[model samples]
Target: MRIFLYSLFLLFSIVSHADGERVNIASFSQNDINSWQTKIFSGETHYAFSTMDGRTALHANSTASASGLFRKVSIELSQTPILHWSWKVDNVLTGADERTRAGDDYPARVYVVFSGGAAFWRTRAISYVWSSKQAVNSHWRNPFTANSQMVAVQSGSERVGQWVDERRDVLADYRRIFGKEPGKLDAVAIMTDTDNTGASASAWYGDIWFGAK
Candidate 1:
């Protein structure tokens, strides 16, 4: 599980840029995802371009598997701290406790990674997740590492099978969770994993971007 966490923060050579006021991350609506790369741990979670709600989206399906799609990018939070995206889940995993390693599975999650540079251990991340049981707005340290904080941005089956828009001020979230200033954003990732719970889950992700608040 620790390895899975570490891989999510691995720095890559590719770097992306922002426009005047927005940094476009995943352009799934354009059917363009060439900037993203896959990282797998345990079994593979299938990801493909698909249509959802009359628009192009990225679909992820996991069956007792762990995998993610990430893009290495550099963004100054002082300029564009707001992260925006949309997602929908088929259903929440049954009998899953997000606070434990054995049940550390999420139907959908978006990660924002901060590079640690030379001292790799200092690298940190914030996982904005669609929780199965955790309350919306509740947060806790990841089961495998404190460096990664899990925030339940969405919860339960009340809104299953429906597209939900999400927005987060990454800079404020990092400050709240770590009690310190954060470096430039290094990467962004999305995953729908069920390896720990040994269950099945499915989700669709719309376009992702960062903009000024």
Candidate 2:
């Protein structure tokens, strides 16, 4: 078996307020990457800040590499279940099949990780991705790990280089996909990678937050 070492760095905490109305995950408006830590998987994906239409956003450039920025967070689905964010991809990866491990590369994705405590085997995650070929609104088990599922929120070159906003009811999606209730969300992460296809990709990420319906 191939040993994969996953490194996790805690940059900051994103906690819901007592009223539990909303939780801010990343402060992109402040052009800050300080509260986000980098984790290298294959090589490295350059992450920084750039201005788009006068608004600051996180930019990522990858050349056959895999890495990401993540933040430890605690969000209650019972209170705030909706997740909101925006992203833009310069181009879609060619000849990439999201169902196969060798084709497991994306231009942009945001995911949530859940911990299973002592039963670490039960840990699972849901990733929202911009797919290269998969149809929009489609989902499948990650080719590398069954515990992590991927959902194609955006697909093709239809929206390339265009900023698109997205909102999802994470609690509902999790229940539908996992067929069970989920524990507190352990973390939230963003990634743009092209290691599998050996292609280059660039993307931009806007402010991310969670809120009540």
Best by lDDT: 1
- Over 12-120, each residue of candidate 1 has an lDDT whose tens digit, in order, gives 5648597958899989988899978888887999999999779789999999999988888998999999999999999898786779999999999999888787677
Model 2, 100-198: lDDT tens per residue?
Answer: 878889999998887766566676788999998898877898887788888999999999989999999999999999999998887788999888889
All candidates: TM-score: 0.96, 0.92
Query: RMSD in angstroms, all models?
Result: 1.3, 2.8
**Model 1 alpha-carbon miss at residue 178, Å:** 0.5
Please state the error at residue 169 of candidate 1 in Å.
0.6
Candidate 1, residue 211: lDDT: 96
lDDT (C-alpha, whole model) for all candidates:
0.88, 0.82
Instruction: Provide the lDDT at 3 for model 2.
Output: 11
Candidate 2, superposed: residue stretches over 4 Å from native? 1-19
Candidate 2 — which pairs collide?
none
Task: Give the Cα-based TM-score of candidate 1 against the true structure.
Answer: 0.96
